[model samples]
Target: MDKYTKIIEQIKALEADMVDFKIVDFYGRLRHVTIPTTNITDKKLQFGFGFDGSNFGFAETGKSDFVARPVIKDFVELDPCLEDPTATFMCDVYEAAQDVKPYESDPRGILRKACNYMQSLGVADMATWGPELEFYLFNDLLVRTDPQAMSAEIISDEGYWGSQDDDYSFATRLPKKGGYHSVPPNDTQYQTRVEAVRRLTSLGYDVKYHHHEVGGPGQCEVEFNLMDSMVAADCIILGKYIIRNTAQEFGSYASFLPKPIFGEAGNGLHVHFLMKGKNGELVFHDPNGYMGLSKMALSFLAGILTHAPAITAITNPSTNSYKRLVRGYEAPCNCCYGMANRNAAVRIPAYATQPEEKRFEYRVGDATFNPYLALASILMAGLDGVKKSLDPEGKFGPLEKMDKGWEPPVSIPASLKEALEALQKDHQFLLDGGVFTKGMLEKFISDKMQDHLRIERTPHPVEFEMYELI
Candidate 1:
């Protein structure tokens, strides 16, 4: 049998009652349409399914028609979260016009174009990424937005402050900022994360490890092994889906928000990447270079550090993202780099000694990012740096060698508005090679500005606290 027939047989073996086509929206959310498995056919899968793109925030209503075509090679035999047995496949969005071209603004399409552009330039055959997923698991969350009263409360049994009135409570509660790798009673989400990892493994994710993070209030992390750029993006989306649903199944809620609580460790999505040549040789490792990084690697690092302010407009898009970048949270506030320095935006892992394992980590990003756009923009910026042969040595630095009181030349953007403004002024690198279109960048800015404005117009509880007595 051919591949199509084999896919049909596999679905049949899964006993799936429905087939779901999953597509990534402009904002990095997974939206889908499902059809009865019996109704699926080779032609329908090949031709595609129609959807309204305006609903996905992709276009105006009049020009909203789009097609989602299943990527046959990318699929899950059965979705573990849905009540109904379903076969799920990741899809590519295309225009519904007479020519049926790939949608230019599609997030996944943009990343795919970036990868292809890299190949065409003959710089590297492919780029690989490993994203460290960090999040919080809350036992319950309550929010009230009434005119008379506005409040938000987080309730987690594992939190030290959430102790019951009963005696001997101190022994069980995790101390503030002391939950890192704490076992059992202090780490209530252990089994839940184990099951989540089990589900992810069943779905073909190469999980490196899962553990409690430094937040005393239910913060958790799951790290994945390196994979190609496109596949890595897919994993980030699916991983979040599985994690959230798994949390729900365990009677909890999972949040990827950068800063959910004050005076606590916050979530971050640090990405590690490296490039390989057409002959499959590592393009980033050089025995004679600094920290075993080749000149190209240094230039790539320079590109990201150079464009970080603009890039955060996508990688750290949300208004609250900057809240996590504050001092004392281990988040990078400066554009400098250092070996194993958590305070630097780019950190060279001390453990990755082998040439194949050598790679750099960008610590400035958060989970608020739309994976495709974030990774693509970073790659584009780095490639631009490589093309220009930008030198990172004297400027951004190996921060460890700097004098004790020396300040870096640049800092990461302090707020969303600032980052967006930076992008508005410096997005030429993204426009090159047609990977990221001008229209897409414009829409992204317009939409994100709306987010900033909405937050600005709202009155916060803290404002009430400070002004009520006065």
Candidate 2:
């Protein structure tokens, strides 16, 4: 039998009761349709499946039809979270029009187009990225919001919020804001985090490690090894899926919100990544250069700095994201680079001295981001810098100028609306190579504006605290 036939036979052997065809919407939520094993066949596979795009925050009701074509290599035996004996695959969406092209609103397709643009520029065979995924596990959550009532509360098992009230002798609670790499007894989510990592490993992800982060309130981090741009994005999507579900299995809810707590630490998805040159050699490395970062890499970084204001719309996309990126938190808000400086938006890790190990950490983004748009926009920015020969030396980066009172090239937008406004003005780089079309950008901006307005219209209960006295 052919490759397709072999795949069908393999699925039949597994006796899968159902298969789920999944894809990510523009906002990064996984959307899927389940099909029973009996309905899975060659004819159905070749013709693709139909779905309503309007419901997915894509098209209008008039043009809602879209096609979902399965990516065969993404097929895997799913965790029994869904129906029993089930399989799932990630899919690419196609417009229902006559041309049958990939949908412009599809973030995955956008990333593919970005990769193609990079290859066309002859800068590198491919780019690579690794994300340090950080999140929170809340043991209890309560929210009451409406015209009638508004309130919120969260509790973490490892948090010292009310440890004195807990009578259990085995309770493991850390001090206020001091949960960094805490050992098993001190880290309440230790087994749950390990189980999540194990699930990822079983699914073929190269999970680096897992630990309690510095939130001191059940904040956790799981790091993964570097992979190619597209695969890395996929891994992020998949990794988040496994981690969240595993947390739920242990009776905790996983949240990727950048600042879930008021005064405690927040989550940031710091990326440590490198690119490969045309010859497949590491492009960021240069023995003669400072911090082993080649001149090309500096230029690429300059591109990122140039576009940092706009890229924030994609990286830190939420209104609450601004709460985590404020000063006094060491969450890089400056558009500059430095050697191992936690305060710098882009920092070259001092520990990575080997030629092959040369890579920079972008500390601005968080898990609230859509991995596809986040990485694609970042790659496009770097490519623009390289193409324009933008310099990150004294003019753009290199740590010393900040002390000399040299203003950084740019600053991060303080609000989601501000970031979207920057994106609206500086999205020409994103428009290059037709990766992101005008219509897509327009829709994204319009949809995100609603989020900003929603928060604006809501009345925070905190107003009552001060105003009631007046």
Q: Candidate 2 — what's its lDDT?
A: 0.84
Which residue ranges in model 2 land beyond 4 Å of their true spot? 80-83, 163-171, 404-406
- Report residue 95 deviation for candidate 1 (angstroms): 0.7
| Residue 48 Cα positional deviation in candidate 1, in Å, after optimal superposition | 1.4
All models: lDDT? 0.90, 0.84
Which residue runs does candidate 1 get wrong by more than 4 Å?
74-76, 163-170
**Overall local distance difference test of candidate 1:** 0.90
Q: Best by TM-score, which number?
A: 1
Per-residue lDDT of 1-470 in model 1, one digit per residue for the tens?
66777787788888888998999999998998998989988777787899999989899999999999988873446787898788999899999998999999999999999999988888899999998999999987788988778887877887777533433545557878888998988788998899989988887889999999999889999999999998899989999999999999999999999999889998999999999997779899999988999999999999999998999899999999999999998999999899999999999999999999989999988888999999999999999999999988878988878778777787899989999999999999999899999999999999999999988888888998799999
Error of 2 at 285 (Å): 1.1
lDDT of 2 by residue, 1-470 (tens): 65566667777787877878888888888778989878888766665788999988889999899999888762445654543777777888899887788888788998999999998998888788878999988886778887879987776667676643464534577776788898977787888888888878876778888899988879899998888887888888888888888888899888888998888888999888798877679888999887888989888888998999999999988889999998777788789889888878898899998888888888999988889999999999999999999888876567854567766757888899999999999999999999989898888889998999999889889888979898
Indicate the worst ten consecutive residues by lDDT in candidate 1. Answer: 163-172
- Candidate 2 at 400: error in angstroms? 4.6
Clashing pairs in 1: none
